[model samples]
Target: MNSFEHDVAVQATNDDAQTTKVNAVERGYYEDPFVRYFARKGSRKSPLINRGTWVRVQAVYDSVDRFLEIYRESSCRQIVSLGSGFDSLYFQLQKKSLFREGDRFLDVDYDSVISKKVEIIRTNHELRTALRADLTQLTNTCGARTDQYVLAGVDLRVVEDLKRVAEKVAGFSLEAPTLVICELVLIYMEPKHSDAVLNYLSSSFTELLLFNFEQVGPEDPFGKQMTKNIEARGSPLMGLSAYPSAQSQKERFQKLNFNKVAAISMLEYYSKCAESLQDNVKLRIRVFLVLELIRMVKLVQEMLIQLFPMVAQVCKRI
Candidate 1:
């Protein structure tokens, strides 16, 4: 594990607090009451992220739904959500009655966020006690779900915590295909730490993974601006060490041996459901890149040659 300083943790805690205050339903769903209220009350024409990006957010929702649908078809009804931040999907899904009583779903995150979620679920008498049981042995009758699955608080950034929490889901039969989600989280860590996460997830699951991430393109306007903003804020966390391109992402996945690799853009998903949105609201999505999680690998040698002066000289000799 990389040695993270106190400031980083403080900053992350503050950021998470601010983020959790905003409901995902509001930011993601156009028709959410908070979104409508903000639209009516705020002087700003659009949200900081914009409607176009929110349209892209639908790709996340759709991907999760697709994973559940496919896994359900295969008789594997467990869904594991990693780094689940204020996502209302669990409650929404339960409301829709999509999953059978036996279907199991678990959301993992930091303590504070999970605590908040526990309260939200506990309000529904049937959903109470979502976190009382240990996840490492969930299938041991003690953790079985009769009506709805569960939401648990566990940090994924820490490998031990991830393994401890995931053990519950991992205990299930390998024949029971699992759908693991690592959404909008890889960018939070430095490359090496991220590698650990990828390796852990890869080893934990034998079947499927639904991973979502963003790439830092050199020409991306927002990415450049965000990097500048972070630098101005006296922190360089937003700046990427290497511009993680789509090609590199795909290459890593291929190395990991994940098959049937396909790249789906957010643009395609929004286009299919364009009719549901408002006329003034444009549903623009830029998928720009994708890679299967199990097939990906990050080669440090190429990066070293390009970045280090001594390595560049050594490569030129050959």
Candidate 2:
């Protein structure tokens, strides 16, 4: 079935994301033991690609971590990942104990994607064991649930369908602190359709934190190239032009009646993430030492190249 927000080409992007994430993990940009299972073997990526992938991955992980920390005393909490495809967050959180008995982690996506994911979970012992999942009771169009986790197949544009799954099926608490993650999912649909979903979330949930990581600035040169490339693949980012920058995102959320809203470009987000880490004295010292060692190595290499050449000329003349 064709999803309102994610179609075939957009579905394929899941594998691309997986490959890119696995590449970043392999290169020590981050650590994700579960991502490799969802990704097929692929070629190595450039440092820029790795860093970008790391930024996106780390953003969601850190966001979830902070949310859990802030809402630790709450009786109920929920994390809803829109268009979650082969995402490893559930497994990661399970290991970290951040997503425990009282907190719900729901993954929503197209029926086909969830079906395949359920099938994979059935066969993959590691994934199945981690979630303690049973595929025998998979919903006809949705997916399975184990303990605090639920995977539902529902179109985001249809607010009623999403409401049914979230409220009745998945048992998401409306009064709970909720973290809604929509990474590169909404931009596939027209602004009207995406706005409907956004409106539904902003209004329905009492306490909500919606995190969206999406492409913006289709008019810029780099943005134009990105748009052209994705369009060539038969999936144009329709909402990109509507919400073309971080400021636009913030304004859009504010117009939706969100009390608190902030948006930053990917580079700015990366810098802020680095700055947050630098607050830790141990990490700051380690980073400083690493940089100093690199500087010393470069200096020694320079001396060997230039000074050694001059010394060889003098010895030959003697």
Candidate 3:
């Protein structure tokens, strides 16, 4: 089966394009030149979808920021992004001065994705300078790695492959305080595969923080249609049925022996975090516009609520 990961990247790029056009930088959404290079021209997303993406990006950024705040005194800090796709969070964080010295960012994905990303990085001076990578040192299979950044390829289903990629390509340390991001990636995998990846992380990393962002609520009308639609497209949400709600997602981590786990739906996040941002007046206005758009398209709103209901969680391993 063809990996549907590229589709997700395209959607994100489209969202970034829309968010950039609307000047929503405060929401932590960025228009990556690499993404723009691959994005289809004239592609646009609905305002509500764009706002939801904005909220999602903000939630992830805030989680990472909180992690940094807690580990500011620590000598080693790292971020490992699974299936990083075309997202440029690492570069953006560096640009915003959030990433400090002695901090490492690693991005792992399928070989094809990593190859294209490396090509873009090699061609773009900004990305090359930010990563401090020597283009002469990179290959299609093994990505460029510098003091602060590492990009490598991995097949998440294989434990040995993950280990090799981490140890050989990325030189990741288990002792470092690491934040593992699995945004919108796990749902595409089989339950056993995703569970294996989670179990490996849980066992290997001593001080680990996991941030998972994905769709939930599979029993709802929207979820049913969403699953059907995606399956019809030949890309099923293989793990959704196993962890279909916020509580279930939280319990999954607790069962894996995480020290602490907290999960909340996107609606709750929007109410508490997104709407309460005092500094971003423009973001607040965009939230209102999304609500109004929701009212105008009730059916679309229902599908959006049901099919796109995202659960974000922060899990800690002590």
Candidate 4:
């Protein structure tokens, strides 16, 4: 099927009567096995698109675990996942016992989107009942403890509601550490929203940030292609504006007075955990120019030239 046709076909399957086929628990952009299975079920004409979809899924999740690790290490009891979609962070943390007695977990997502998820979690015996049982046992096995857990539906783009919940949960004191994960959400907004978010996080939260972003500047070939594919899939590319070049990203944090700033290419992050990735999964990460703007940029530039000799020729010509 053509791209639009494929999207239509996917949408058709979401009709009221047809919806009974999937059940409450499995309804998400990525949750449906068939959508994923077939979306990756490639044809000769669009192998790249299929592979890219798989890569996108893998990249998002790969980063998720990494973000979770940061959360675990922050030693913060309170955890907030901004723009938490079908993210399994809370479930994973619960299973791993990453939070202590005073730690609180809150998931902020759009009301409509989260309502569906909440319904699924509420109705599905597995997520609420079976999965919890399984995780509770695992938590016991791992000795990971938590004081409290809560999932509140809020729009991250709307600062008022998000701030209210944050204040209520963590309070304005900022005495205890709070880990806030914005993940891939900010990119959907204009740069102004991103600026506000960065400033808010820096001021309101204490200690540590795990930010994952993309760059869509005119200079990037892969980025251009990636944006085309995203829109082709019939999903709004709202977050495209949020990605910035390495220098721009560095300046953003610096503007907000972030105490310690370290930047890593998505490629570097993937490489750091390469040994741990599963065999069935394939990961392709490129942050070509973005990484070039980090501390000691010249050194990383020299290394990139060594690793990608062809790029060096292209750069010299440019």
- In model 4, what lDDT does residue 178 have? 55
**Model 3: residues with Cα > 4 Å off, grouped in runs:** 1-38, 132-141, 278-284, 287-318
Q: For model 3, how does the per-residue alpha-carbon lDDT over 23-85 read when each residue is reduced to its tens digit?
A: 433323433343343333444445555555666667777778988898999888888888787
Q: Please give, for residues 1-318, the per-residue lDDT of candidate 4 as tens digits.
A: 354553343233223112331221132212333322112222222222222233334454554455456456544455566666555556655565644555666666555445554555555554564235321111111111123544455545566666776666434335444555655455555567656766666766555444444443423555566567655655434544444455555656677667655555544543565566553322221232232232444443322221100000000111
Task: Please report how far candidate 3 places residue 119 from its true position, in Å.
Answer: 0.4
Ordered from best to worst lDDT, the candidate numbers read 2, 3, 1, 4
Candidate 4 Cα errors over 4 Å, as ranges? 1-76, 130-147, 169-173, 215-218, 232-243, 276-318
Worst 10 residues of 4 by lDDT: 308-317
- Estimate the TM-score of every prediction: 0.64, 0.84, 0.82, 0.59
Candidate 2 residues lying further than 4 Å off, grouped into runs, are 1-6, 133-136, 275-318
Residue 5 lDDT, candidate 1, scale 0-100:
49
Order of models, best TM-score first: 2, 3, 1, 4
Candidate 1, number of clashes = 9
Q: Listing every candidate in turn, what is its Cα RMSD in Å to the true structure after a full C-alpha superposition?
A: 11.7, 14.4, 4.4, 12.8
What lDDT would candidate 4 get against the real structure? 0.45
lDDT per residue as tens, model 1, 227-291: 56645544454314542555565555555445434443344444466666555443321111111
